[model samples]
Target: MSIEQRIHAHYAGLSPQERRAADLILDHIDDLALYSSAELAEMSGVSRATLSRLYRHLGFGSFTELRETARTLRQQGVPLGPDGDPELSQHLDQELRNLRKVLDPAGDDRTARAVSDLAGARTVLVVGLRNSHPVALHLKQQLQQAREGVRLAPLPGQTLGEELVDVGPGDVVVLLGFRRRPSGFERLVSFCAQTGARTLLIADGTARRHASSVDLWIECPLGSVGPFDSYAAAMSLVAVLADGVLAAAGEDGRRRVSRTAEVYAELDELDLR
Candidate 1:
């Protein structure tokens, strides 16, 4: 049986103290990922020994077993992993797998959807701060090339607000913000909620809003490329998304972008030896 169901079946039988422990466990399975039995106990306010006992009563052979069960349950629907930096550079295989799972789920439909959202957008605003900013700017550049009204605001304060104030229904906000909390991403998302703009956030972990709340969410594995979290997987996601949109924007957007490129207006024409 599932951890939840097993716990719930014995719910009426649990003593008040056990119930308290149960409540804590149920609400915070993910936090348990980082906790030892003692740490879990401290957070749950149950004694470490009692916490172990409570999980035992729930049918786990050990605390690790309980944690693993909870982990599996939490990840059932989402495509992701533990919250860590992309710059860590330790887990390329894991990151690649995560990217594939998310992008290939339903055969690149997610990427296609991201593009469709762009093709339909009247204005597109992309936001990210700190280690995440450059990726957001990269996405904005792609959208601009597709002839969308795309703008990326500098981090912090009213500059972001002014950008968001312009978003309305039929607009898309593609936000990239992750662990350690990217400044201003959450507040912008909340503001957009009121404006009725569509929001798509790329963040870390399984939480829909790892750094900030958003409408559509894609979870990218954190990695490291030297000091920066490896955005390899994140970059792959954006590349695929841009390709999908560029392809979906059809003859009109294609013609417009092609004209600009052909005339070398913003497009540069340089000969290389």
Candidate 2:
């Protein structure tokens, strides 16, 4: 069993002091590998002996064993928290690293090809689920400004089957599939393939499993100092991709954008204030 499971199993049997330490351990489970027993004891406001007893009760032979177990969990893509509270500078550094990987020049050819597909397709469908929805919506909005025939899937209460019914040749499907994707995501990709629609997958490392199935895959790094995954790089890539599509459309795209602005002004659709 995992360290967490062990802790819960023996939680009721722990002494008051051991329970205190256990509570602290549970709160910082992600950072367990980074803390020494002494540091944990200090942070938990308990004696070192209490920490020792707590680990023992958790089925760890020693503190080192406990830490190693936490490390292994982290390596398996578990969203582990930082050793301690992270500063703004640390968060910025991680975001910069992610952007560097996403904007790397080595993948210029891939980006160019994706842009060409989006630019030439007769219809473009942007799909995103869960945390990926906003990005998909934003990409669809941007693409629409560049040209017509752009739409977002699963609009509010709708299902993907309805949106995908007409997707086929001369169509491009942009799928934003980040981590924590639903079980049926792979089947969605397969369905797109069966319909003869060109597919582009923009996702984090977890989507590498499906990379081979799609026509194009753009991987974005989402490591963050905190527990939650960051999407700064993914958002930046969307901007770059939208710009590429706009450039590919040339004067036609410019005219469409101008006309869109004119309509928005006529309808007072935007709140500039």
Candidate 3:
């Protein structure tokens, strides 16, 4: 197993100091991988000697191996945090860190573009099965606020394709899928291609089987909690995407969110009579 995989496997079981070491490595991934143990230890307010012990405990022969691993991860363009390298923990410092990276100025353009597409699209249909459903629903809520003409599929009797077929050339279909891959989602994407609809796939990595059907992609880390995956980063991405749509909507966006509240409140206040 990779150092990261090992770290995660035993993450919860790690003592405070060991976690401190892991946190340090996680906090400054590129730097740690690029520098020596002494350099990395200094950054974490810890001692080099202590870091050396931690490295050995994790089964690395030397700091050189650790550095090599970090370098390899860097080349892979993988972000080091809870999503890419999660540990079993109640807190989600990694997600906040990852969110900051995603919200970086460089990443804002893509967010803006995605939002604009949703706002302008004739229809917006979403797909997410398994753990991705929450993220998909969050997007649906935000887009409902960002602008109208949004829909979520696989609800009630409607299948994902049932919604996919309805999107015309200017419409958008956002599919949320990841991990171990799903052939059925890919086929659904293929069906979307036959339609005139524009497509977007929000995924976790460079894997592109389902990415082929979409015109754009948003990649984020999939955080996990124990056997369960963390959807924090995915939710954050949904937030960012929604912000973009809200930006595009101007006054109309504000009104939509406000109106949604009014309607929901009315529903809640009613006796169902």
**Candidate that scores best on TM-score:** 2
Q: Which tens-of-lDDT digit does each residue in 13-83 have in candidate 2? A: 99988988888888888788778999999998999888888877788889999998987666445788776
Off by over 4 Å in 3: 1-93, 223-227, 269-273
Q: Give the lDDT ranking, best first.
A: 2, 3, 1
| Alpha-carbon RMSD, each predicted model | 10.6, 3.3, 9.3
Count clashes in each candidate, considering only residues at least 3 apart in sequence or on different chains: 16, 0, 2
lDDT score for residue 46 of model 2: 97
Model 1 agreement with the true structure over 33-90: per-residue lDDT tens digits: 5567777677778777777678778888898898777556444332233444444344
Q: For candidate 1, what is the TM-score?
A: 0.59
Best by lDDT: 2
lDDT of 3 by residue, 1-273 (tens): 777677777778766777898887766654455466776776667777777777887778888988888656643444433333335354467566556665677554766677777878988988777556777888897788778788887787766656665677888888787554455766777777677787778876634556656777777765433234456777878887888888888998888878877887878964555
Q: What is the lDDT of residue 152 in candidate 1?
A: 87
Shift in Å, residue 133, candidate 3: 1.5
> Which pairs clash in the backbone of model 3?
223-230, 224-230
Model 2: residues with Cα > 4 Å off, grouped in runs? 1-5, 14-20, 36-85
lDDT of each: 0.70, 0.89, 0.71
